[model samples]
Target: MDTKSLIIDTATKLFQQKGYIGVGLNEILKECNISKGSLYHHFPKGKEELLIACLQNLKQAITIDIEKIFEQYPTTQDAAIAMIEKIIKNLETEGTLTGYTFSSIVSEMALLSDAVRNACGELYQEIESIYFNKLTADGFSEESAYSIALMMTASIEGGIMLCLTQKTSEPLKTISKALPNLLNSNIHLVNA
Candidate 1:
């Protein structure tokens, strides 16, 4: 990969492992084997700028993953369960969910930087929108789809945290099992 891509990738992993505030420029530079001069060349505003880039990269990568799951599954319920299962698998294999979500960054640096906050917010919205669109396509009203999307997004994020903290995929496994029932209940509510 190119220097800029390499820096972003290394920084992303570091940021995921250690929150935005927890990681230092020296750590990222050493990890990437790049100098401060090279980092600034790619990110003129330094850490914040690099962070925003990392968030954007994460957004793109995750968007593709979600979209692909939506394509492969026949229904939103299946897709949602699959998404949770994917996370569960990641946690099981990696022994952590750090690489899968950026909630740590949101908790640590969101309040400190508007640019960072906006980038994280946009990433979240993109993920929610994918779910929302799939629900609507599966016949949910816009309002219902929006609500379900929000719930699913929040639940999955919380599940990831639980899995990380509890060191078990049971929370996510429960989520995967619950999603179908949740989606079906919403369908009934909409029909009624």
Candidate 2:
């Protein structure tokens, strides 16, 4: 990797694992096996710059991949199931608590960094939009679709945090089983 990319990637991993404040430039340099000059060359603004880069990288990756996930599935039900299943599989293989990096970054840095917060907020909006589009296409009314999508997105994220905190995947697994019902409720709301 190039110097800048390497530093950015290194900082991302560190921040994900250690939180934004928990990591410093020297630690990132040591982990990347680079000198301070090299680190400064890539991120002249220092830790703040690296943190911004990391947030941007993650948000971009999420926006593309999640939209693809929503597009590939034929129905909202399928997409929700797939989303939950994918996370379960990730948990099984990557360790249950290992992949909450983005959430960790949100918890630690969202309040302190406006840029990071805005970028991450955009990703959250994208996620909600994906769900809303899928639900609306699947027979939900506009308002109901948006509400369901927003609720489900929040619930899924909360499920992940609960699963991580409890050191078990059951929270997510149980929630996955009810995703179809949660989705169906929105359609019913439209009917009523």
Backbone atom clashes (below 3 Å) for every candidate: 0, 0
Worst 10 residues of 2 by lDDT: 92-101
Q: After superposition, how far is residue 157 of candidate 2 from its true place, in Å?
A: 1.4
Tens digits of lDDT, candidate 1, 13-118: 9999888889999999998898899999999999999999999999999889999999899899988888888888888888887557999899998889999999
Give the alpha carbon lDDT tens digit for every residue of 63-93 in model 2.
6766777899899989888878888788778
List the lowest-lDDT window of 10 residues for candidate 1: 91-100
Per-residue lDDT for 119 in model 2?
70
* Top lDDT model: 1
Please report, in order, the local distance difference test score of every candidate based on alpha carbons: 0.91, 0.80
| Candidate 1 wrong stretches, greater than 4 Å | none
Instruction: Return the TM-score for each candidate structure.
Output: 0.97, 0.90
lDDT of 1: 0.91
Best by the TM-score measure: 1
